[model samples]
Target: MFEILLALLAGIAAGALNAVGGGGTFVALPALVALGLTPVTANALSRIALVPGALAGAWVCRREIGPVGPTSMRELTAVSVVGGGVGAGLLLVLPASSFDAAAPWLLAFATVVLAFGRRVSQALSDRLGRSVALSSRALLTGQFFIAVYGGYFGGAVGVMMLALWGIGLGLDSAAGNPMRIAQLAAIFASATVLFLVASDALSAPLLLGAMLVGAVAGGYGGAHLARRLPAPLLRGVLLTTAVTTTVLYFLRG
Candidate 1:
């Protein structure tokens, strides 16, 4: 009962964070690890559980979804799906010790990105005096790599996407947010399929179901709430979550 409740609350927080700005894995992955699942299994299960939440957020923002710069939405999504599947396959094939060793570093890297990605994007934009327009090939290539990261150990992948778009396409994060949510759904959906078929995530069915239910509710509500919350407040919440998660992971290591 305690584990179920904990997972449910973590899922709610994770789903809300993802809907607002990303970093859902920062919450869900750690929570599952605390529940005694191995790091690799926790990562896979968290991705599986969050799929519905990402989908719910995407559905709510479907009308606002659009292409990122020179890349068409269709092509970008295709790349994300393929890259995500490949990443998931990598996770399944890799040794569990490798994920355990890398988990803290991945969390730290994600936290740094969440903290400074926007500032860096803005700075680059200011220096250039215009959006650095990447060729479509470049944009797709960048997105594919990010999707691979998302599939392997997504933490702030949505924020990373927004930062890339902000720098390369001069797209505003607010304007690109819906599309971020949609692409997140695509990545997680692909990853989830791989996890279900190839991983041991289903071994903890109760916890997974609890988290999934909470994530769905939170995602739907968070998408609506995100429109109303002040931007600074949302960023503050996300940064706090990211920082705290990263710190705890480092300490645990």
Candidate 2:
């Protein structure tokens, strides 16, 4: 009962974070690992559990989502879906020990991005003296790789997407947020389908159920709350979570 309650709370935090800024994996993945799932299993289960949350967020932001730069929404989403499935396939094929070894480094890399990605995007934009939009090919290529990463680990994938748009098209993070959430839903949904069909994530029905229910509530509420929250405050809280989670992962190593 306590574990179920903990998973529920973690899911709420993770879902809210993903809706607002995209560090949910840092929360969800760790909580599952601590609950005795292997890192790879935890990753698969968390991704599966979070799909509804991502979808909820996307639904809430549907009206605000638009084409990103020169890329049509249809094209971008297609690429994301394909790339995410490919990545999830890799996860299932790879040895579980490999994921365990790589988990800490993945968390660290994601933390660095969560901390500095926006600043780096701004600095590059300033250096260019104008927004330098990527060709459609370039944008899709970048998104494919990010989606692959999202399917595999997905710590701060949404922030990575926003940073990509910010540098390439000079899109404001706020304006790009709806699209980020939508794409995240695309990535997670694809990954979840693959996971459900091939992985052992369904083995832990109780934990998954608790988290899924909590995430549904969190994602919907968080989407509404995001419009009213200060961006700086949200970012600060995400950064803190990212840092703390990353440090603990490293120490656990």
Candidate 3:
């Protein structure tokens, strides 16, 4: 009962974070690991549980979503699907110990990206002396790599996508965020399908179901609340979550 409640709270927080920014994996993945799931299974189950929230967020921002750059939505979606599938396959093949050993470093890297990705993007833009725009091929290629990473660990994949768009297209991250959320859903959706077929994500059905329910509620409410909450407050919450999760993973190491 206690673990179920913890998972529910983690899901709600994670869903809310995904709706507003992106760092939900940092919360959901670690929580499940602490509760005794293997790293690979935790990653797979987290993706499964968060799918509803991702889709809900995408729907809420549907009107705002658009092409990341010269790349068409169809093209990006294709790359995401292909890359996500490949990443999921890799997870199933890799030894569980590999994931355990790498988890802390991955979490730390993602936290840094979440905390400073915007500044890095801005610096790159200033260095270029103009808004950078990528060719369609370049955009798709970049997105494929990001999608692969999203499928593999997820953590701050959305933040990384926004950073890429901001740096490459000099687009405002805020303006591009809706599309990021949509693309995130696409990545997670593809990976979830693979996990459902190939992983033991269903072993803890109760935990998964609870988190899924909580995520749906959080995702919907968070999107609506985002409009009312101050941006600084949201950033603070996300940053704190990222930092705390990263530290915990390191301590576990």
Candidate 4:
């Protein structure tokens, strides 16, 4: 019971951090493992919780996301869905222990990006404001890869999506937020289905339920704050969280 509450609280904090900064799982993932889940189970369950939060974030940014046009959104979302499903399938079939052993290094890399992600995002938005300009192929390729990574492991996925959108999609923050949210949703949606269908009942139901509630709340909060706060400040917070989480993870090592 205490562990469930801890997970719920950790999720809420992560959601709040992600809502404002991005990558709250840096906080939640390790905590879940500490509470007794295997690393892969913790990572997979994190995706389950992420769905509602992504939806909440997208809903909050709906008006801003409108400028991207229905056609583009529909098309991009379809690609993301397919890519995400494939990635999730990969996770289901592969031995996560090998990946799990290497996860800390991946998290470390993600932490590096978290520090400068927003600044890089702003720069990409400004410099390339040049739209991949009807290059359907580039868009498809980049989005698919991002979706796969998003499904496989998500800590650094946002940074990756930013790069894909910035270069291939030539997107600005307004369009990017909703699109990214939708893409992330697809990623988790696929992973969640995979878990529901294949893996033995891996996570504790109580922990899953708590994370769901916390993620929903945190997602709403993060989305709302993304606009209210200055981008640089948000970036700074994200960077700090990434570094802190990395340090904590290493401490356990």
Q: Report the number of clashing residue pairs per model.
A: 0, 0, 0, 1
Give one digit per residue, the lDDT tens place, for model 3 in 110-218: 9899889888889998898554578888888888999999898888898888888888888887798788888888898999999999999999998999899888877
Taking the tens digit of each residue's C-alpha lDDT, what string does model 1 give over 1-253? 9999999999998998999999999999999999999999999999999999999999999999988887899999999998898889889999989999999999999999988999998999777766458789999999999999999998889988998888888889999999999999999999999999999999999999999998998898899999999999999999999899889988988
RMSD of each: 0.8, 0.8, 1.1, 2.5
Candidate 4 Cα misplacement greater than 4 A, ranges: 66-71, 118-134
Per-residue error (Å), model 1, residue 8 = 0.8
Flag the better candidate by lDDT, 1 or 3. Answer: 1
* Clashes (candidate 3): 0
Candidate 3 to truth, TM: 0.97
lDDT of each: 0.92, 0.92, 0.87, 0.73
Report how far residue 101 has shifted in candidate 4, in Å: 1.4
Q: Model 2: clashing residue pairs?
A: none
What does candidate 4 score on TM? 0.88
lDDT (0-100) at residue 79 of candidate 2? 95
Extract clashing residue pairs from model 4. 19-222
Task: Estimate, for each residue in 130-243, the C-alpha lDDT of model 4 and write its tens digit.
Answer: 643536666677778877877777786766776656654566654566666666776777778887777543448888889889888988988887778887777777777778
Ranking by lDDT: 1, 2, 3, 4
Which candidate ranks first by lDDT, i.e. highest? Answer: 1
Worst 10 residues of 1 by lDDT: 125-134
Candidate 3: clashing pairs of residues? none
